[model samples]
Target: MTSFQQLLTDLGNKSLSVLDRNIPKSAYVPLDLSVTNAALKEVDVSSASKLGEYINRHIAMNEGKVAYGGYLEKRGIYNRSDYFNQQNPETERNIHLGLDLWIAAETPIYAPLEGEVHSFQNNTNFGDYGPTIILKHIINTVEFYTLYGHLSLASIENLQIGDVFRKGEQIATLGDASINGDYAPHLHFQIIKDIQQYSGDYPGVASQKDVVFYQENCPDPNLLLRL
Candidate 1:
């Protein structure tokens, strides 16, 4: 493993959930796309409303407040032609790079560690992160970045670069389907060892060919979430 990867593993042991502790472990459910299911296979996941209803059903069935997306999940939700070619599933960017915490709109999101706002942007593409924030952090002198995507547009208002935030501080709130790149309400949290010259926005999903590289750059968010 890379030294950075080892550092992330170490941080995981000491990190806290990005959500409030009062939410309870029972409020979280692991969502796996690898399972063989007709709902995922046949449903129009690209539509925010459709996906929101699907996620709501999952929450209802499990009695959880949020649904968690596993690392490296082959999510078919990015099949929109604007984001990827619907004609070619093989070339689609369907593999999830970040860990998604699906929840209701306007739900508050917290910082898992002490950091400063590195950058923020409104990536207003049809299937893009509506308003995203990237925070820069240095732990044990190991510099890394944390990305928060699909957030409320208002979260970026009055924000400036280098804005400091404490651990567990309220950083942003979840955005609904209409605003959050037309997807269900969720927080796409990712860790980047190197941002590769990107600012405010980075790829949260990877095509098959680039998945291995992203796997190295963006480690499993569960390391920090611990849920």
Candidate 2:
């Protein structure tokens, strides 16, 4: 593992949640939206409502409140959106590079670690992150970032750069399909070792050709989430 990843791994065996703390870890169940999942063969998730239904059913069947997991997962959900459709296997950006927490709209999202707002904005595009926040965190002299995407519009209305947020503080609430890129309400959490020049936005998906670079730059959020 890289030093940055090691730093993240060393944060805590079980880190804090971006979700509510009252909700125990047990309530955070794993979800598989990868293309390899045979279950999604006939089911369509490109539609926000259809995906929401699938997620709701998954959460209910698993007896969980939040369905999480998707780091490095190859999904077909992006295919339906012209914004993400490239029709090229090698260059198509369908591989999710972040961990997603599937939950209801307006659900509160917290900071997993102490950090300041690096930037926040409303990314308007089909199948894009609506209101997003990027937090800059420095630990043991190593600087990194955490991204919170698909947030409610109100989340960034009054936000400013460098705003401080203590770990576990309420940073933003989840957004609904009408605003959050036409998808089920969920928090797209990602750990970035090097954010480069990105401010309020960063690539959350990777093409096969660029997966290697992204895999290193963006480690599995589970390293910090541990959910």
- TM-score of each candidate structure, all chains considered together: 0.93, 0.97
lDDT of 2 by residue, 21-126 (tens): 8898999889999989988876778778888888899999999999999999999999987777799999889999999999999999999999999998999988
Worst window of 10 by summed lDDT in candidate 1: 81-90
lDDT of each: 0.84, 0.91
For residues 59-105, could you state the per-residue lDDT of candidate 1 as single tens digits?
A: 88999988997588876556564575446655678788899898888
Q: How close is candidate 2 to the true structure, as a TM-score?
A: 0.97
* Model 2 RMSD, rounded to 1 decimal: 1.0
Clashing pairs in 1: none
RMSD of 1: 1.8
lDDT measured at residue 190 in model 1 versus the true structure, 0 to 100? 94
